[model samples]
Target: MAGALLGALLLLELLGGGDGKNEELRLYHHLFDNYDPERRPVKEPEDTVTVTLKVTLTNLISLNEKEETLTTSVWIGVDWQDYRLNFSKDDFGGIETLRVPSELVWLPEIVLENNIDGQFGVAYDANVLVYEGGYLSWLPPAIYRSSCAVEVTYFPFDWQNCSLVFRSQTYNAGEVEFVFGVDEEGETISNIDIDTEAYTENGEWAIDFCPGLIHHHGGSADDPGGIDVVYTLIIRRKPLFYTINIIVPCVLISGLVLLAYFLPAQAGGQKCTVSINVLLAQTVFLFLIAQKTPETSLSVPMLGRYLIFVMVVATIIVVNCVIVLNLSLRTPTTHAASPRLRHVLLELLPRLLGSRAPPEPPRAASPPRRASSVGLLLRAEELILKKPRSELVFEGQRHRHGPWTAALCQSLGAAAPEVRCCVDAVNFVAESTRDQEASGEEVSDWVRMGKALDNVCFWAALVLFGVGSSLIFLGGYFNQVPELPYPPCM
Candidate 1:
């Protein structure tokens, strides 16, 4: 009976332990809290990602006072996921809040761990919800309680050398490790890299710890939080290809064009051709540039601007050619100049200006034609001499005149009397020319006119080349700063 009584007491003790609190704990195992059915979809797998990355930087906002929050923005790569987050005013030490879209959030299974301290930590607010999805099976948010300490090794006391930096570490999981690369199942994440390294570290010193937003995504048990990451804050200037490729080349080419003045126009088409050829070569390079770059409707690139300028200059050159040709065509008399102005201008001016005298002219424009005509006439005269004097005369002369008279006429005609007529004409022309020369110092006005025209052509071509090049080179002074102080989409 005492044993039974002890058993009953033992059963009662067990019954008492099963109370409301215990039942509540048991039920909680199957139930969930803080359920968000409307949570955002995960971000990843987009051909192009667009982000409004604003990196606000402030330096020693009054060094006497304690350093406050300084906010900034930056864009991650396009391949990564994009996330939009809001930052509060007190976040960067006490500057304005910056709203930014982080392109890095687009990657697969990223985990973000925040460990900030004090009221500054409370003031800092970041939203890391999903923005888009190319993958499924995303893990729910997890809160891990831990203290964070950030020790900046070489924090710049002055804002002059400060910059924002974003560092990333990527990992893969069990099954993923076997198939592709960077064994994700391993403890250390593979392929952790900084995307902006190409632009920020080329021998320039800067200081600005611009705070950036961090984004992360995690997978479920089937997918299993395969990646971990860490990010560092850095500040830097965006890459500016316009300054290097476009502005520099345009300036250089323009300077070369301005040198056109140094080339003599009488150099015969070479000066003009050189300028045009340079412009043409630039155009070819421009074509190559266009082919290799992405097509965008956004503002044109600096290189494109340079190309347009060169093409315009090339057109101007064509116009200058017309002008030079016109000058060369000008005559000493009113619109009566022959094409010989090219030679006359090339010749007379240098000699007139105390340079060497002009080259002598060819005896005639074409020597063969004159020689052929003269040879024919001489052959006909020889044939006439071989014939009898009677046969050479008119038909009636043989019957109407005596043989003696005919003989006399033939002797006079054949004995070079006709040659004297040509000689007389030549002598008359020589005397008239000689008299003109004696009166006016023997100068050909045509030759003088040509020289003056060549000088005009040379100067005109030079001016056109100079003006066009100058406008393009000086154009940099007229450029306005970009509306967004960041790099554009590739």
Candidate 2:
């Protein structure tokens, strides 16, 4: 520190004398004043400059699937040899290095065209360190908000390819250009050491492959192309979270929809409510799926498509419940069973399904003596009503009212035959009641129709539920197998 202070005092004294004999200070002034501002850092007027770049990805900012935008931060070191910026060793007290304003020397005008406009991060050639041998290297770090087209055909289990395209703006192919360095002195660049170890792995995404290279593409009508540095980033979804939280729940809900069919038609109202809830659950999952994937309709996500399919099947189940309830509640007086329905559902379908109706309850036996007397009485009454008085009232009355009433009728008949007519009238009344009781034993057509409908629909629903869920869930399982390939399906 004392030696540097003494050297500063000596330089100040020389500058105070105004004779301009200070070698170090004068060398700095002379170099800056005498430098040609128009000259480039090249040996020949048209000699191209070759730039070598090394990069490191620091962090990921955001990836917008719907808008297809990716924002990240990176650090790049650019190296190039400059002849115009070199200085003689003997000029300034044998100084071997000099740090000066970067604008004082020529710098490459390479820019990343894929970067989003109006949101570029601050960057500048802040300080340029020039060595005595004309070696110029600049290390600048920037947060690049680049956007790329996103393909989300297999979302939640999907992988996307995005790129950072670097190009030149100020210098074109006509004047200054760029060339990519394949190796450092014929040694391959280490791509695996791109600062990935410290990367903050996103909760929803994982890096598949990050390969960067330089390639010169031909010019187009819009702009002349010279050189481009493309850093390809392939990222795939981390689907464990979605599979457990979203996909599994959705699948279980779909299974519930299939089970809704098992609820008896007697619970049709409850079954309809359950089916509606399944639809609502699917709707919620569908919304979540839309949030996870891009807006393109090129293809549907496996989970989203599955949810939609289950929703459709659930709607059909709702309709089936309505039909079952309607059939089960029909009344014989208002709605009789159609012949076609009876043949198809009651007879044909039951035989096809190998099903049988529930047995009716046992009935009490009629009194044998009463039944025989009634049968004889009915014959007498029927004969009396059709064939005048051919049958004797005393004979039929004895069976229906017993021998006491017959004897009373026979004694009364001696006075007047019309008086015995009372016994015949009682027989007629009993016969009418027998017919009404017989009709009550037969099952009503409406009840039989309803039971037939319930059995048929129950078996039919079983088949549909099995087939529908098997096909749909199996398709989803195979489609979402992450290890099938880089791009499994579109």
User: In lDDT terms, which candidate is top?
Assistant: 2
How many Å off is the CA of 184 in candidate 2?
7.4
- Score candidate 2 by TM-score against the native: 0.72
Q: Candidate 1: where are CA atoms >4 Å away?
A: 1-272, 288-294, 326-423, 428-490
lDDT of 1 by residue, 224-284 (tens): 4442222333323222444466546655665464344344433436657766766876777
lDDT tens digits, residues 303-348, model 2?
7766777787788778977887777666544565668877887678
TM-score of 1: 0.33
lDDT of each: 0.39, 0.66
TM-scores for all candidates: the values are 0.33, 0.72
Q: Candidate 2 — which pairs collide?
A: none
